[model samples]
Target: MKKQSTTAALPGKKTVTAIYIFVLAYTVVQLFWWGILLHQQSKEIAYYEQLELTHRVHLLREPSEFMREMQRHHHEQRMRTLKYIGEGTIFLIIILAGASIVYRAVWKQMRLQQQQQNFMMAVTHELKSPIAIAKLNLETLRKHKLDEEKEKKLLDATIRETNRLDQLCNNILLASQFEHQNSQPFFEPLDLSQALGNALQELRDRIQSHDILADIEPGIGMEADKFMITLMLNNLVENAVKYAPKGTKIEVSLKTEQNDLLMRVCDEGNGIPQEERSKIFMKFYRIGNENTRKSKGSGLGLYLTRKIVEQHGGTIAVRDNLPKGTCFEIKWQDYSLQPV
Candidate 1:
């Protein structure tokens, strides 16, 4: 499917934003202008009252009373001027603060919408490529008589493509379930060592190009949901595969420290930027422009991984994997076996 272009709307959005800013500026200017006019009018009224008082005092020949009335009139004018200035200042502050908040919210929403559009485009391409390859492979097998080796290769390729499609579908479904709070992990007694080893072995089998290494502690048992744990591990490894160069070392380590279970997935790839590390887990968020990015992904892996970890009472963090790479570290606190 051809991806829809959003470039055409860029200028329109910018124009709208410019207009909004212009209106806000104009309003602030008008508010200050009105305040100035009110201040001038107040002074004029005070001057006229003072002149009237003088005229009345002259007619009644009351010099001391005139002086006292003049003082009172001046004080009242000053108080009125201060009151107008104070009220105008308060209103101005409120208007600016409200405008700032609205602008940030609108900007954030627009960014999220753009990311979602990118995700849709990526998913379309991702879904099509695998399905097309698998169909073509099957058709080739049916239409021609091939040697045993050739047949095995085609079947293997078809299986890989089919698995990729299945995983994409699973990620989408699981993400939806977690988003709506409709899914809960069914906790049970799990052997952490065995599960981690199996997941790593499966990943190694699926991705033959990468050198996957594991350092799992033996007999580390924990109470957890096995399926969710496997899914989480797969996501972390898949993410490493997507970024890391072919044949580079991808290390998976699991160990226990002071009643806590720690799992780290380190990749020998270009590390994530410091500023973007925090945003990687947000749904539908990708590091670069989706249209131009060469990597194939639906941007749900990290998000789903984080959700699964959180669901199982664990914390996940990312850091620079020494020299040149990224490492995803996960910790489950106070790990212990529970009755099944």
Candidate 2:
């Protein structure tokens, strides 16, 4: 089915074009008016000069005061014309600059709206797929009598789908909280190693195709919310699983550096381009178009991850892994050890 374009509904292109045309036409008209004013002032000066020359010739004995007064009047007239032109030029430049700013703001808003529309569609599809799959499995279980191993496999699949749904819902809620700047998580000492283990365990069934090489530092702790940290790690791991090819290894580690905790996730996948590194953390800003996207996501994972990291006085950064793939590094600042 052909997907409907969200940007098609926005209605500002024609209006913006008209505004630009009007500004251009107004600028041309102002320039033309200035040219005519200058021509008229020159003509007047020439006419007066010719008259003074004739008067000087006809009345050679006339006083020099008349010529002095004529010169003074011409000087004042020239100054007035110059002042008007200067003020008009400044006004036109200001108007053009203001229009450009407004146009850029409107363009950015339109892009954001389109991205949000895409997000809604992606979320709806993502939610529906897991529910539909789980429902089908349930119906099959109720209708058919399956053997022991087969039944277990079906049950595990159903559980995996359910877990996916739960994760999706949590992402939506966390994204909403971050969007509204209401992410005041209860901070305390959290075991970083345990959090990584739990997060990896949650995705063990889902990541059967890839190998996870974890080298976590033992007894490493930091000031953070455990649940939030788990969610953040889950998101990063899930993202790596989705993007990285099957059979490639994913690396996870945690260590301390100068009173800060450093968490790292490395995946052997097609690395993110340098230009798109900064934008991946914006809400609803996906790398590709939603209509033809191959990956299953609502584009909220990295954004929520960044928000969670920031809430804990931390920073997250992306880098190219040596040889191939992408690396995600997170640093938590002002870390405190758990009490003995």
Highest-TM-score candidate:
1
Tens digits of lDDT, candidate 1, 1-340: 2334567658868997999899999999999999999999999999899888877886666677778888999999999999999999999999999999999998888888888888898899899999999999999999999999999999998998888898899899999998889987889878888999998887887899899999988888777899889989988999999899998999999887887889999999999998999899999988888767888899999999999999888999999999989999999988763322
TM-score of each: 0.94, 0.87
Q: Candidate 2 has which clashing residue pairs, if any?
A: none
Q: What is the lDDT of residue 291 in candidate 1?
A: 62
For residue 219, model 2's alpha carbon misses the true position, in angstroms, by 0.6
Off by over 4 Å in 2: 1-63, 334-340
lDDT for 6 in candidate 1 is 62
Against the true structure, candidate 1 has what lDDT? 0.89
What does the lDDT read for residue 319 in candidate 1? 92
Model 2: residue 192 alpha-carbon error in angstroms: 1.6
* Weakest 10 consecutive residues of candidate 2 by summed lDDT: 1-10
Per-residue lDDT tens digits for candidate 2, residues 1-340, read 3353445553456676788789777876876687678768866876787676666665655557666656776786678677767877787788678877977897788788878888888899898998999999999999999998988988998998888899899999888887788868988867778878778877675668789888887787667798888889888988888889989999998887777788999999999999999899999888887777778788899998998888888999999988999999998776655532
